[model samples]
Target: MARPVWSGALTFGLVTLPVQMFTATESHTVHFHQLQRGTSDRVRNKRVNERTGDEVPLDEIVKGFDAGDEYVVVEPGELEDIAPGRSKALEITGFVDLEQVEPIFFDKTYYLGPKGKEYAKVYALMEKAMAHTGKAGIATFVMRNHQYLVAVKAEAGLLTLHTLHWADEIRDPRKEIGDLPAEAAVTDRELKMAEQLVETLSIDWKPEEFHDTFQEQVAKLIEAKRTGETVEKAEPPAASTNVVDLMEALRASVDRAKSPKDRRGQKAGGAAKTAARSTARSKRPSKASSFDSLTKAELYERATEAGIPGRSSMSREDLIEALRGARGRRRADAS
Candidate 1:
């Protein structure tokens, strides 16, 4: 069995429990090696001294900090002497409501449990208290010679540790993001129609429902190439691709959502699509004009079906104008 990464005491006031920490999550990413194009030679990197451009000898290196132009090198015993016992003690300073910590602050989590029989009662007490109060203990501990801000929480009838970020680690998102329009300018009728459209499209959050289509395609292409199949090189994805129109995009999304994968059961694909669309104007609709061909009356009816805001008060012209304009804007601005 693998040895625990950390062994410590979970102490708050008079109570203390000896515990061991083990990793909670495992990763399954495929790893790759840098190989020569024509030969099977593998590539590797070495630490080189910047000034001399020579490989640095690891044994000779010492931990150091530069203050202005001067350097302060420390011995192996120095760090442990200056700050110790943090490794052997997960000192809980305080407890706060779990909701106070946002998802962003957490880095990684690990499991913590009693190290031996003597600590079982104390371990159980702390875990039960955290679970009952729905609070997490704000604590600090050392692991692999590095200090971490840790949160002790109850998980599956046991205590779990989550490493947290230091104050300077998190960046404020407002720095990169501009303010967005919180309220729509559309009438109640248009809003109601949009709501109905949303209802028709809504689904539970099943992560497996979606897959990275590009990645899956790439994997398929690679498999074919490996099996000696002749294949054309795929085009690279464009950076900042051109946008699709709003009404068309939304309509496409709705159609895809409602259409049965087994084509036999589809009811709306026949005459209704023709009534909403004008196929007679041109044998082939230039992509941009198809959205425009949908009459103001069709747009309003669709919006009404979608449950857009103030549907009863808005005229047919108003509803069509609003839906088309909003959908177009949405398509253009979509990332």
Candidate 2:
């Protein structure tokens, strides 16, 4: 079990329950340590005195706030003495409909669990009540020397505390983005086609379906370097079409959505010729493996089934090579 980062009392009205806070989410990004470019020596950062150009010890360090011509130095104990004592309790000020809380205000989330068996009953009662009403409790509590605006909501019989940004923190996009586009006209036919394309590609929301592709590529690059393998750079994507080709681009996009990798020969009079070529290729049957004819999407599916690592970010050619290696290994295992 994961350790709780905080312990406190959850208070509202006459109810008080001992609760512990555990982080609800964690990042999976690969991190690297700083090292010298040509050597194995580790690179480190140090605190130094700017005036004397000397390294400073941790005990000698003091935080200061810039005040015009000079800085006001403050001691750690002085700050702690003034820190709010409300950190020991999460006190709910009021309840509001969950829909009122926009996603932009939400920051870090933590799961609030009952601290002891005796508090479990009250904890569950509050959780079920909030879930049933579809409401969240608005609260303010200090944690780690900072007071946070939070929304306490119930998720699967557990209370979740989401830190929220202050109202002033959310900037007005209209002012920052400047020059909003004038309302443009869209044709009925184009609208229908766009909606149809969206419907064709829509699927049930599954968080697991998405992943960090760039991070996976970075990991693959590091592993390749460690194993002395040659890493091929991917070709850059083509620039987007100009405004004149909007209709044609939309049509092509719809076709690509309808058939993920089969939009190459989709012109008005090309179907017959495409069919003839396919028929001839089917009859000729080259000595090479059928995998060569598969599209990148198809190759990725096969690589996934074969349990090839780093398949998520592999190019079409790299996927083909990995699949070929997997086939060889399977044959050796069978032999």
All candidates: TM-score: 0.64, 0.78
RMSD of each: 12.7, 5.6
Evaluate all candidate structures by whole-model CA lDDT and list the values in order.
Answer: 0.70, 0.79
Candidate 1: Cα lDDT at 187: 57
Q: Write the residue-wise lDDT of candidate 2 on 1-335 in tens digits.
A: 89999888888899998899999999998988899999989999999888998999999998899999999999867766775654687889899999899999999999999998988899999999999999999988777767789999998778999999999999988788778766778889778877876885565665665567667778889999999997657556667887687666666555544442344555644776557546644654343557778767657656654656666566767788888888889889999
| Residue-pair clashes per candidate | 19, 0
Q: Candidate 1: RMSD over Cα atoms?
A: 12.7
lDDT by residue (tens digit), candidate 1, 1-335: 55777887888888878888889977544356899899889999988888999998988777888987999998756666655574688888999999999999999999997898877888888888889999999988766667899899998999999999998889876675678445646656445655756987565565543434445455556788889886445435335522344444555445533433422355555685655534532443343554446654445445644445554344444466667766777789995
* Poorest 10 consecutive residues by lDDT, candidate 1: 255-264
TM-score of 1: 0.64
- Compared with the true structure, the alpha-carbon lDDT of candidate 2 equals 0.79
